[model samples]
Target: MNAPAHDNGRLALMLNELRLPTIGRLWPEFAERSDKEGWQASRLLGALFEHELAERAKRRIERHRNESHLDPSKTLATLEFGLLPMVSKAHVMALASGESWLEKGATILMFGPPGTGKSHLGSAIGHALIDVGYRVLFTRTSELVQKLQAARKSLQLPSALAKLDRFDLIILDDLSYARKDQAETSVLFELIAERYERKSLLITANQPFSGWNDVFPDPGMTVAAIDRLVHHSTIFELNVESYRRRKASDKQSARQRQLPEKNQEGGTTIMS
Candidate 1:
């Protein structure tokens, strides 16, 4: 009778059959190193498994990051914390880790003016969460509401909401930009209701809750939306000088200083 195939060959075949390409490809080199170094069988196997697990984790994180649609430039590393004192660095870091209040399907409301870093901060948080394996999707509130309205018109709102559930966190930027139409607000309400107590939301709004009435014309709807969102939420009020506005002013001042002075009669005059 022909001798049975060797155990090493059988093991390689089985690993490939299971589709564990990483482990299968590396095992031959791992075994060679073990023999050359006189390593214990247990130690050699442990190293192999560790390498496989690490590679799998890296690929998983990469997949999540690509699907997240986050701003590659926005992250805590790039944040100008000194420019905004109202927001605590420690608190922002805690939330970015996605292991604190996010556990309870909580909401985060970032309130600030247009020139402030509201959208930047929101996208940064999403990037951080995705790095640690959280699924995040970021979009403008107006754009998202339009999509929901389209789904409703097509009678596929439920399917659309179900697809959105794939994200562990949703970052909705510029909430105040959503039009104050009844049809639009209704879909927005539906999204909030679906995610309530189920998934986390981070919203950046140029207006405060009191002014939210301008987005949802119905007073009852405004009250209901605010009540649900703020009940289990953390609000970040960035009451700092507008970063964009300050930069623009600085540029204007530099230009003015570079220009030659003109007398009231409109002739260029050299300064003494």
Candidate 2:
């Protein structure tokens, strides 16, 4: 072989032996292009890999959360323009500042009517707490009651309550959405009793203390639950008008209105 041809062949073999990805090596132009655009090739690749890994991790986390029957996605961070009491925010920040949920049991009760953003605030706090590496569990009141009932039927009520005790903060959203019987009350009280001083709880309700008698089905149990929950709980009564009502505009209502049409027998029918 000619000397020049031999040198070229050796150089090609060495490039192949380098074992860089074909795109990263033979297509070095793309790498330079990415760099000329003020982007780091390695960083871009790293970012892509990181994003892909994070996406996989997120999917796995979502699956585990689903299987655990606790929805972390319901937290307040996901709400649009969420608002919480100024003092409540300070208290919440103080709780999170402790760097641990086990430091002290801080319970929050967000009570208001429907569409009042109670769930949003509760869920956001849960998310924030979880972000700080605290074990936070979020579930609707109805769902929690149902699970408690099932656990009782299986003779695992204590275990269920104990598991709840493990959470740094347990967020019960939408309380009083449905009525609860005495049996449910007993089960719920067991949970509260177990976590009395061990963990924190965040509750969002559509009803106030006065209306809770309808939920517990007995004045005694209602008082018991309220006492345990409110003993060290931070009660935030969100008395603002329903968010849905505030968002509705008169022009929107006018546009949504329907014109009246003359029907048979000369009677006008409003077509809504």
- Maximum-lDDT candidate: 1
Model 2, span 66-118: residue lDDT tens: 54344455454454443433335556555544454456675788888887667
Instruction: Report the number of the highest-TM-score candidate.
Output: 1
**Pairs that clash in candidate 2:** 75-123, 75-124, 76-123, 76-124, 77-124
lDDT of model 2 at position 138: 77
Query: Candidate 1 residues 1-272, lDDT tens each?
Result: 97564688898889989877788989889998998999997999899889988898899888888887787887888877777778788988888899766678999999988978887888888888887878899988888888999999999999999999999999998898887864476788888889998888999998898889888858899899888899889998977789667757877998777665435347767667
TM-score of each: 0.83, 0.60
C-alpha lDDT values of all predictions:
0.85, 0.65
List residue ranges in candidate 2 displaced over 4 A. Answer: 1-92, 95-102, 181-183, 244-272
